[model samples]
Target: MDPAAEAARRLEADPSMLLCGPLSVLHAVLDVVVRAYGEAAETVRAALDRLEDRVLAALACRPHRGHPLPGARGP
Candidate 1:
């Protein structure tokens, strides 16, 4: 569930949260937000890793160029 909904559910399910003060509520919300961000970051990192692996594999399959004379002072 989304952070707001989760926080609301927590508050409703546990009335003591309201008596703890606003900071407690804020902490609960922030905790959810932080966890969501961490999950998203991990997803992105895994995708990038897969992409890098594919690129490296493709490059490894290609033949190397033996000639280079575009702007060289060849002997």
Candidate 2:
């Protein structure tokens, strides 16, 4: 059941227990939001790890040549 609807049902069932029902609903929603954020963080972390690995591999395959600055003395 939807969180809002469930909370409404609780409120309607007992009008006097005002704070308790709504607080429970709020807690449930926050829990879902937090979990979603955690999943997103993990996804971004994996993507960055893959990008770093690809970049390092590409750099390793290239031959190193020191390019002297223009008009500067070369050894």
Best by TM-score: 1
Model 2, stretches more than 4 Å misplaced?
Answer: 1-19, 68-73
TM-score per candidate? 0.73, 0.61
lDDT of 2 by residue, 1-75 (tens): 354565567556766656666676676556656666798899999999999999999999999998988899977
RMSD of model 1 against the true structure: 2.8
Error of 1 at 54 (Å): 0.2
Prediction 2 TM-score vs. true = 0.61
**lDDT by residue for model 1 (1-75), tens:** 689888888888888888879987897898889999999999999999999999999999999877977998778
Number of the top lDDT candidate: 1
Q: List residue ranges in candidate 1 displaced over 4 A.
A: 10-19, 66-75
